[model samples]
Structures are given as structure tokens and as C-alpha cells.
Target: MRSSLIIIGFFASGVVLGLSGKLPNGFDFDKFGSYALYLLMFLAGLSIGSDKNSWSVLATHNYKIIWVPVTIIIGTLTGSALVSLILPSLTMKESMAVGAGFGYYSLSSVFITQLHSHSLGVTALLSNIFREVFTLLATPILVSYFGNLAGIASGGATAMDTTLPVISKYSGKSYAIIAVFSGIVLTILVPFLVTFILS
Candidate 1:
């Protein structure tokens, strides 16, 4: 929640800077952005790999439930592909990359910005952020109509942390396991998926 707001603020600040034409001259933004992207990816990997609990969460989970995240990914990518055919603004690769973000806006947007263009990165950021926000705001209605797992699916990569509390409240404590499991799996896949699609 707070992080989303902070990202929006940063994006808005960047837009303001660009509009003001105050960016420093003679600096290679492409080179700097590439380095920054590499650093962010490294740090993200380090943070996850260093956390023993992250692996433990996966290791201890029932393998049967793995299908949940798998299904989410398939559905997301499928929808993205279909949308690509409909919307001329995005190609199949671009749409797939955007969908690959799931709900991990920060990491995915950075990857897209580097691998694709800033415009596509902004689209990924908005779409992914909306995924999380929709889950947070509509969990109850989602769970009520579409069932408990619907909330989990809507939560996407945020199910494990940001949307977990709401999901727990509406979907019952039993489903929290599935939510966290799917969230972690999707979060882990975001960078790999985006890079793969963009490549």
C-alpha cells in the first residue's frame, strides 16, 4: 500500500523532471538505467535467496496446490495474448511481458523499462498496480461471487503479503496457505517471465 504510493510518487516526479527539461546533459541514461536494472535484479535475488523462510515456505507446501499459481500464470498470459490481438497499441510480446508482471509492479516495471520501452514500463506499472488494488478493494465481493480462490487469483503476487490480511478475513484462514503459496510462486517468477517474454 505505502510502497505503491511511493512508486507512484517517484513516477510522477520523473514525469515532472522530464517535462521541466531539467535532466543533466552528457549523461548516458541508457547506460545508467541498464546498470540500475542489473543492480535491482541482483538485490531482488539476494533478498529472496538469503531468506531461508522463502524456500522453506515452498518446500513445506503440498505439491498438489502448485497448480493454483500455474493456472494463474496461464490465465494471465492467455488473456494478455488475446488482448494483444485486439489492441493494436501492444504486440504479443509486449502484452505478454505486461501480464508477466502479475502483481509485482516494482520489479516487473523495471525489467520492462530496460528490456522494452518506458511507455510499456508505465503500462505494466499501472496494470500490475491495479491488480493489487483491485484485490485489496474487492476481495469480499470477489470471494462472495467467484469463491475464495477468486480473491487469491485477483491478488496475484500480492496475495502473500499486501492482500493477505484481506484475503484471510474474507476467504477464511484455511485459504491463506494457498494465497501465500501462489503469491510467492508468482513473485519468484515475475522477473524471469518478463525477461523471457521481452527477449
Candidate 2:
């Protein structure tokens, strides 16, 4: 909990500093945040890259991993959609935004904020935080019962960052594949997904 706070604090501080005009003139803090995200992904790749066995397994039996992501995506969509329907005020697109929390909060929030408004970003941030907390709390139990995919889905996009260690420890080496795949796919999907939702 403390460590998580520290990590989030750093990013949050960056936002504050950015807003305060502490960053160099003409240097976009938002763009810096995006670059930082990529760097984190690169480091995650390095960590996973060090494990040859995991990489080999991913290369050989990649199809098996897809089921996990498919299940997670379906679950997120269902959960968010159900919540939206129950509320009756939220739109389907808003529901989808809420459901995508598998660590996608920052990017999604930033995207929504830039394209739409701060309110949408705020919604995305809060929902994503909820999603991540749920993932962290349920990781041990879910890893035992629902398996790696559920665990991965719990962390959402975070499986590629600081949460990767937790995932590697709890879900085993196999999940590294899912983490990398989800991260890469999500990274690419961000712009497209946001555009679709905004439109």
C-alpha cells in the first residue's frame, strides 16, 4: 500500500508540477507522461526479457494466452455495462470507459480529457483506481481460482509496470506473456479506442 502510494504520488506530483509551469517552456508535461509510460513499458520488457524460459513459452504456445484476455475483456465489458444499465444515466460509451480499467486509467483519462473534458478524465481516473485496487486485493484468491488471466485482468494495464512483480510472484512465469501482450495491445489501442469513444 505504501509503495503504491509512492508510485502514484510521483506521477501525481508530476501533474502538479506540470500544471504549475515548472516544466521547461514549451515542454508538454502530458507528452512527458506519455513518454514515461513508454519507458516503463521498455523497462518491463527488459525485466521479462531477462527470463528466457518465459519468453520461449510465450513464443511456442501463444494461442492459449488469448483465452485469458478474451475472458477479461468480456468480464470488464459486462461489469461496466451492467453498472451503466443499473444507473440508467450513463451512456454505453461511458460504461465502456469505466470498464477498461485494467490499468488503462491514466492513458484513457488523459485521452478523454484532451478530446472531451476534465470531467471525463476524472471519471476515468477514479474508475481505473477502483479497478486496480480490486485487482490488487483479489490477486491471491483470483490467481488460485480464476487463474492467470483473471489475475492479469485485475491489474489491467498495470501488469506491465510495478504490478508486474506481484503478478510474476503470484501468477507465475506464464503471466509475463499476458502482461506484455496486453500492454502492447492496449498501447496501440489507446488512440483508436479514445477516438471511437469520443466520436
Candidate 3:
């Protein structure tokens, strides 16, 4: 229900943007969108931060859960490598940088747009947007079957921050600990990973 509402809201905003011709003119959104993303990221940080016990559980658990993130990284690397291979001349670093954007669409789109030009920015933005949506929809099913680790990874990088509530909802209290840990680790890794892959 919340996801549906979010999707609806975005769709409505898209309509408004189209009708008003008020789409962001440059890499930056009008102040409102920019602030909203910042707030969202901050909220994610706050949510995860407030839950210290989750981290303790993660440390206590057999580190087997680590594989969940490892698989996610591997998937990311494989996708980046394949894209680079197909593009041939595109270096591994560049592909990985693109991959590191890792579905953190809003900021990635803004930065990529500003740095690389609008087209690549749009690609980054759209891919991140889709990844978020995909993760949102997939969370329940993944948690039910593949378990919390897989569910968290399904959100890819967004799991670090924005997707916690959803993960918590589906995966239960224990998942919160994992979610916080995942969020921090991924948040720290995203920029470096993207740079490493892209550069």
C-alpha cells in the first residue's frame, strides 16, 4: 500500500512536470526535490542509526549473512563487467562506476547529470528509480523465500537507507539489525565502489 502510494505520487508528479514543463532544467532538481532526497537519505540514516541492537545481533550471528552482500557485490560486478565487455572499449572501472550508482538514483542521477551530461544522468536516474521500484515490489517475496539478506540486497544500494521500513515489515525485527548493518556498509561503499569501477 505504501509502495503503491509512492508510485502513484511519482506518477502524479511526472504528470505535473510534463504539463507544467517544470522538469528540472539542469542536473539539479528544483529545491524541493533536492531537499526531499536529502531528507530521505538522512531519515534512512536516522532510522538505521537508532537501531543499535540490530548491529549487535549481526555481529553475534554467524557471519554467514555476509554472503548475502557478497552475492550482491558479485552480481553488481558481473553486470558491470558484462556491460564493459559488450561495449569493449569501455573500461572495467567505468562500468563499475556506473554500477556503483547501484540504484541510489536521486543523488546519482543529479551528480551524473552534472558531471557527465544529461543523457548519462538520465540513464543513471532512471536505472536507480527502476531499481528502487523493483526492490520495493520484490521485498516481500524475497524475504519470504530467499531470507532477509537476499531481501535487503534486492534493494541493492538503496537498502542502506530508504528501504529499511519495508525490509523490517517483511523480514521482522531481526531483519532491522541486518538492515542497519547493510545500510551503513553499502552507504560507505557506494561512492568508492562507483569511483573504482568508473575510473
Candidate 4:
């Protein structure tokens, strides 16, 4: 919770700073942002790779565990399709592209902005942010009603980080491995899926 709060606070600070238009004149956010994202992704990969427990959990679990991330992908995209019907303005592909973010807002929004319109990029950012916030707030209720896997699903890509603590608290430590695995798979797929759909 404290970590989540700190992250949110930093994000809020950035927003305020950006909106203030007081940044240094020579700062090249566009050029630097992509490099920063690459570094972040590399660090995330290192974190996962260095975790011995995460690997052991995979080795112990049934091979069928692969289905978990697949189920999440299907369900998320299906829900996005339904939402597209209501939205009317966004096509099915566009909605699914946004949904493909799976709570990894930073990369998704940046990728979408580069591939598509700025408007769609904003939609992806907001949608993924909402996903993370909702998962954080509702994981306990979701776990109680729908089970641990539901909590993982609700977390999307954040199952590996931001929402992982909430999921671990409500679901169980054993399930942390599953969350990490699911998050890694979804995180890897987001950029490819979103780019493919947009293309």
C-alpha cells in the first residue's frame, strides 16, 4: 500500500509539473521517454529473472498453468469488445488495442501514441490506469467472490508489481508466482498486440 501510494504520488507530481509548463526549455521528453521505458522494461525483466522463487513456482505448478494468462487475454479482449459496442465511436480493433494494455499504461500509451492518434493514446492511458486502480481497490472483494485467479485477472499486468501486494494479501503467497507469471506474459504481449491491432 505504501509503495502504491508513493508511485501514485510521484505520478501526480509529474502531472502537476508537466501541466505547470515550467520544464527546462531544452528538455526532450519525447526522445527521452522511449529510452526511459526501455530501461524500465529491462529492469522489470531483471527483477523477474533474479527471483528464484518465481522459477521454482513455475517448475512445481502443472504445465496447464499456461492457460491462466490465455484466459485473461480472452476475457479482457471480450470485455473490451462488449465495451466497444457501447462506445460506438471506437472500433472493435481500437477498443481491443486499448484493452491490450492490461494496466501497463506507460508503455501502452506511448506505443499507441506513436502508432495511432493522440486521442487513442489518451484513451489507452486512462483505461489502463483505471484497470490498475480498480484492481488495487477491489482485489479482496474479487478474491472472496470469484477466487484467487480472479484477483490475478483483475490485476492484469500489474499482477507482477503494483497490484501484486494486494493480490498477495488477499489471495495467498503461493499465488504470487502465478501472478508474476501471468503478469510477465501479459506484459510481453501488450506491445505486440496493441501494435498489431492498430496496424
How much is 53 displaced in model 2, in angstroms? 15
Which RMSD values do the candidates have, in order?
1.1, 5.5, 5.7, 3.3
Q: Indicate the TM-score of model 2.
A: 0.66
Q: Per-residue lDDT of 1-199 in model 1, one digit per residue for the tens?
A: 9988998999899899989998788988889999998898898889889988678878975777898899999999999999999889789999999989988998888889999898998899999999999989999998889887988998889999999999999999999988888999899999889888888
Could you give candidate 4's per-residue lDDT for residues 1-199 as a string of tens digits?
Answer: 4654665687679889989998999998767877876786687678668978557655655776788889999999999988899997999999999999999887788788767877898898888889999999999899989988988998899898889988899999988878988987788788788878888
Instruction: Please say which candidate is ahead in lDDT: 2 or 4.
Output: 4
**Residue pairs with clashing backbones, model 3:** 54-177, 93-197, 93-198, 94-198, 97-197, 97-198, 160-183
Off by over 4 Å in 1: none
Q: Give the TM-score of candidate 1.
A: 0.96
lDDT of 2 at 45: 58
TM accuracy, model 4: 0.76
TM-score of each: 0.96, 0.66, 0.61, 0.76
Which has the better lDDT: candidate 1, or candidate 4? Answer: 1
On the 0 to 100 scale, the lDDT of residue 184 in model 2 is 49
Q: CA shift at 119, candidate 2, in angstroms?
A: 1.4
lDDT (0 to 1) per candidate: 0.90, 0.67, 0.67, 0.85
Return the candidate ranking by TM-score, descending.
1, 4, 2, 3
Q: Name the runs in model 4 displaced over 4 angstroms.
A: 1-61
Minimum summed lDDT over a 10-residue window in model 1 is located at 56-65
Candidate 3 lDDT over residue span 29-112, tens digit each = 545665775686577667657877546645756686676666777887788778877876556655665666767765566555
